[model samples]
Target: MGNYRFILSGGGTGGHIYPAIAIANELKRRYPDAEFLFVGAKDKMEMEKVPNAGYEIEGLWISGLQRKLTWKNMMFPLKLISSLIKAGKIVRRFKPDVAIGTGGFASGPLLQRATKKGVPCLLQEQNSYAGITNKLLADKAKRICVAYDNMEKFFPKEKIVKTGNPVRADLVNLICSKEEALTFFGLDPAKKTVLILGGSLGARRINQLVESKLDFFATHDVQLLWQCGKLYLTDYEKYDSNTVKVKAFLNRMDYAYTAADFIISRAGAGSVSELCLVGKPVVFIPSPNVAEDHQTKNAEALVARDAALMIKEKELDSEFEAKFSGLMKSVQDQERLGGNMKKMALPKATEQIVDEIEKLLK
Candidate 1:
């Protein structure tokens, strides 16, 4: 393996950051002598996470434009200019063999500058619906790695590669037993378990629904393993008990997947990919307040294939009980959903994406 220098840029959320990290980790494993530099937006989670993963990272003075009018919007031009200039300097100094972007604010400037400097660039678009930054970079990128099909509508058809989103390596081949997972969580092996996930910041509607329906779960002899997220931990921690296990975060997701007979989650691209691999029946409540309502689109794609179920946020209050109760009552539906989801799992996604990078380097 060559002692190649590589630059990776992505952040703003775990969906983008984790995929970038996964790709970088795979590259590092294969090319142990390689040097890596991660560029992320200042104050974003990646600024903290990348370093902890044993890679050096630089922060750019950049952020996304707010949808609604705000003081921050006024400084967008200045920030963009500053970020571009700094990105150019970084590219010139590092002289990377290749630059990869996983779609985030910082990636826009970094990949743009690197591409201009004649560095081979690749993009990994996790969403079915491409983000503005990735779409803009599509033409310049040597390859566009994506999880979804029919992305030719968004990118140059010739450059698109259907490499699914990179998921956690451990989850690709989960080996934990249900009984052991139940013991780890102090859960009952006999009772059906439903795991709820709302990302690291929590989903307000999901938390509210869980809180209101706690008794319903008990009445039906079902148990809850809810990851309510850090932001809402204090607000929902009071409800944690023997039947209901509410946590801010779950470190051992493999065990959680083993214990869960069903799952309710937000449909971020990364979460969707992981769920498909876990093969648990899931009901996605995609947050409506995202770019292009992309979460809804992601969930709809699975729903179209009968691989999963989804309920929109606005329809939650009127539709939650019926949907939840219907799924709970039918064991056949659970099996069908889980089976279909597993069929969609792309276990080799990480490997295929790195393969594309290696081709570019060669």
Candidate 2:
């Protein structure tokens, strides 16, 4: 077997970070002796998460270019220069066989340096619309793994590989019984269950909508396994009822997926992949505060194929309650969405991506 060493760079949100971790796991499964080096923004979530996943990481002093021109923009040039130097140092020392960029600020410097050193570099962009960082790295990226098509608008059409996003393996075949799942969460299996998720860090808009509508849930006999995000507990806790349980995170995500009949979530790429694998009816509230409004675009891609439903963030106040109520009552609609979504799921993408990496190493 060829010596397999990799540098994985990505961070910011779970959308970018989790896919990087999933790819690393696939690499480990394919080549037991493979060594990995993770690169992330110094103060970002990746610093904590990468170590938790059992990988060593180097941090770069990098941050996104601010949307609004604040004092933060003044520090941008200095950070960029320092990060580039740090990236070069890491690449030289590690001498990776391949460098993978999943999508975040840290990826820009690391992938650029790796490509400059003649290492094979791959970039996996999760959104339908390309972000500024990924767009900048596209020219240097030898192959671009993507979840959406028509990306010719962003990257070279020939370099794009539609591998879909990698998801948790347990979610693919969640064969756990409903009774076991409900018991794990201490919920009533006899009642309808709704799972509320707003990405890993949580979306403020979604948490607000769920809190406003909590009292209405009892009317339909739906119990909520509400994941309000650690950031929004103050607002969400005020609405807690016997029928609704609030949590910052769900450790046993398998139980949450297996127990819920319906889900309300942000349309992140990682979440989209997991929802499809779970095969549950979902209502996507795409967070507009995100870059390029890509979440809405991601939801539309599925909605066009009858695989999901989407509601815009601005319209949530006027529409979410009525729309959610109607969907809850329509068993036929739920079944249609679930079936089409499951049909669209790419359960083998994890294996397929690993296979590609193996071929490269061999």
Candidate 3:
């Protein structure tokens, strides 16, 4: 039991990669002698992130097919074939007790090969709408763990498990106090502070929206702690001031969540899950450019339940100000939204997913 080996594959975005890491971490804690390896697309973010998380990873020459005709689409067949062969070799070499996929391009080939080799495979789908990768591998997956309900529409009903999405450990148990969080970021606690997140790479339109509203925030006696992402720091850093703190990235999300009176963010599945645990009033601006438009679907699920508010990317110009201003003006709305959102928190998601993985080993 203690010497179990596991292989995990997920990548491209933090949504997929973080869940895989969270699951691996739980497995490591449960089985200290467990060997773990990760497979990811060669040039994707997972290549760097997995190693930084203290796991060995193999990279495959794989990427998703583009909808429109492109050079990458032309290369898909060759890459998929190359990845399948490499994945098969890895599955044979590692001899893992369980294979886990968190739904990404690399996971497509890796988990497919693992299942074909008779390795028990588990898939985690983060969105309300199932990803194409997960759906394609569903028939062979021993279990399909998901964050949203009605996922049976995508996966075999027998294999579907509503385990929710795994969130980072720090976010699950916030240790910082509001005063300390404000002090750490050098912000005044007297003014209402809104934390703006555009994801790890940043959102261009979200950044633009924030820039246009800086004067509006100031007029309302509010301050801003904006995590504009590393990619957009050069473009948006000029707006940094006493009333506005523009950071390239936030290393201390616990502190950021603690200090915020409100939050504005992109509605990536990972962000949505973390926000549920954080339980703050959030305005989700989902990116329209995702697979199946899942980000909007993620936000809408919460919005439908009165757990959060959503403004689509296209409607941001027309709706953001009115929606945001109205929310800001109401304390009861904040409390209600925050309370309902907390009710949706699945803090034990990682542990539960690991429970499924553990069962596979038996």
Model 1, poorest ten-residue lDDT window?
211-220
lDDT of 2 by residue, 198-267 (tens): 8767778888787778678887889999998888888677766667888888988888999999999999
The TM-score that candidate 3 achieves is 0.98
Cα lDDT computed for each candidate against the true fold: 0.94, 0.88, 0.93
Candidate 3, residue 312: CA error in Å? 1.4
Displacement of residue 65 (Cα, Å) in model 1 is: 1.3
TM-scores of the candidates in the order shown: 0.98, 0.96, 0.98
lDDT of 3 by residue, 125-213 (tens): 99999999999999999998998888888999999888889988899999878999999999998899999999988999999999998
Can you write out model 1's per-residue Cα lDDT over 20-93, one digit (the tens) per residue? 99999999989999999999999899989999888999999999999989989999999999999999999999
Give candidate 3 regions above 4 Å deviation: none
Instruction: Return the lDDT, model 1, position 248.
Output: 97
The runs of at least 3 residues in candidate 1 whose Cα sits more than 4 Å from the true structure, single-residue gaps closed, are: none
